[model samples]
Target: METVEFYNGNKMPVVGLGTFRVENNDDCKEAVKHAIINGYRSIDTAMIYDNESKVGEGIAEGLAEAGIARNELFITSKLWLADYGRENVQAAYETSLKKLGLDYLDLYLMHWPGLDEAVMIDTWQGMEDLYKDDKVKNIGVSNFTVSHLEALLAQVSIKPVINQVEFHPYLVQDELRRYLEVQNIVAESWSPLMNAQILDDEVVKAVAEEVGKTPAQVIIRWNIENNVVVIPKSITPSRIDENLDVFNFSLTTAQIEKLNALNEDKRIGPNPDEFSGQ
Candidate 1:
């Protein structure tokens, strides 16, 4: 698998498995196991998803069966909105670590910017503490816009190493991507396929057909081509395998431009600025 290096010299797999709505413990466990068995080196989960234990179970099982060691896998989880303070954040990570059955995380992210500036600042402090304490290998944020990042960077002693956000052909987030690039922070795409909406786009479909690849493959390739990490969720074994099959083909410059032209600022998830949590 291709990899991206964090500013702190940690390596992350360029592609990973995302566990979002696989709410069932058994299913999430199986999905993680199957994904790892199929050659995925990275796994992405979050506290809000409520399946870290199952993901951990699957990781253990997959590693055992695949004959891979613990350090060979990259695992990630996020701090939820409710855990947005220095006091709550550390405990929240501990809860996820216990649930995931791990000593340390490869990456931990602030799940959303939410509505509290002070709380978010405190959360970053917690993240910095976690990193400094060797509880997590790298730290990042999700759904953070340029404004949010600027605010965080202003007060942070350790800059975020990644920004996982809802990015796809329809919501390219060009300016934010540029900012992250200039700062040497990697951009990770959570909804790289836009909840499968891009599968129906004429441009995506045409490119997929021309390359003899699935629309999902085309989209994933587009993300990789743009130098971004992507975690596409799939519970089905075949789709999980298909998502990682992009390494076999490459998208031409014109085809990539065609897909880039599909940006409409559409988003299938909630806006980070307005989300205040339930």
Candidate 2:
């Protein structure tokens, strides 16, 4: 229900539904629809996720059922590594748009920072063109390191409004977060719950008990308290609803410190610098 404003003056819901591995078309569609009907206004998907059509289907159903207009929801998708060239970027964007059955995306991100800086630059330029032409509401990068951002920032004409990454209690990404803050770019967390692995942490459990909330809620609140955008994915209707029930409670300063202390500089996803996109 809370929103974060981009430098461009567009607002994004602080919490969203992430469709990373929700491969079952029926389940993905249902999850998206359910999330929207239950008060979620943001949805995150990607080209590599291969469920854009289903997501599009869900969005249509959710809008019609919820009685909300297309502008009421924020939809995001990504550009894959294979489509990382100036010549290929527009076609890739078009393909994603066609699949999603939407004329434009709320946010379009570079899925990864690929191995070559030149390719990244070219792809970003293509995205910049899309932004200029009103093809996408905003542009950003995912799984990008500070060094990668430095490279992209030095060469690009348009600055990215956000950097989506694998962020959670164990993977806080302090340096990258600081840089993004300085650059006035928002930070979005992909695996905010660490695929539900963080639910069993002792600290998370303690906080959940104290706050009378679920561990998932505790972790989500932590992200919110830190001003990080979180997208916790779920197909189960109950869990999906539970994930969004984080706005009511506030984590005490000490509890937030405890959660922050759990950071080990760990990562569950591929490292951007070394990932070959295979």
Candidate 3:
């Protein structure tokens, strides 16, 4: 797997295994453990998922089972909206660290942009404090649009190193990607392969046929080819194994253009900008 560098000089894998809606504490742990044993080093989790502790336990189990060292893995966690203030942000991170059973996180992100200026400022401060303390290797945001990022940029001293968002063929965020590239922020993808809208699209099947891979793999390879870090989630072993098969093939430029044309600014997930007051 390839790696991307954060402004702080942290190395993160280009592809990661996502743990979203990973139900049943034991089951979630097992998936994570198996994913690691299968060759995944980057794992994404969030405090709001209420599975941090389980994920930590799974990681511990996987490390012991596979003899993978702690430093060899890249662990990421997020601060929830309830913990948006300065004090609460720090407190939340401490709790997350405890749940994750780690001394420091590879990446710590704001789960969502605050509803107002006060909360946003407080959250930024909390992140800044963590960055200053060297507890979070990389500080970033999720579900942030260009305007949302600009708002935070005006007040915060340290710019976010990354922005995790819903990115896939049907929801290509061209404008956002360009803006982030200009800002030198790596764009991390979520819900990258779970786009229900495109699962039945003829283009997906066509691309899948040409590559002799699933529509999911085609979309994921599209992500990797476009320089986006993909975090695809799956609980089944075969599906997990299938998702990692992107490393063996490359998409041609024409095929990429065809996939890019599938975007209609349609999002399979919620647009926080409208409801979150971004």
Q: What are the lDDT scores of the predictions, listed in order?
A: 0.92, 0.93, 0.86
Cα deviation in Å at residue 199, candidate 2? 0.5
Indicate the TM-score of model 2: 0.99
Q: After superposition, how far is residue 96 of candidate 3 from its true place, in Å?
A: 1.0
Per-residue lDDT for 1-278 in model 2, tens only?
A: 78999988999999999998899478999999999999999999999999999999999999989999999999999999998988888899999999999999999999999998898899999999999988899999998899999998999889999999999999988898999999999999989999999999998999999999999999999999998999999999999999999988899999999999999988899988899699
Comparing 2 and 3 on lDDT, the stronger one: 2
**By lDDT, is 1 or 2 better?**
2
Looking at model 3, residue 38 earns an lDDT score of 86
For model 1, state the Cα shift of residue 10 in Å.
0.8
| TM-score for each candidate, following the candidate numbering | 0.98, 0.99, 0.96
- On residues 76-164, what C-alpha lDDT tens digit does candidate 1 reach at each position? 99999988888787899999999999998999999998888888988899999998998788999998999999999999899999999
Q: Which candidate has the top score in lDDT?
A: 2
Minimum summed lDDT over a 10-residue window in model 2 is located at 20-29
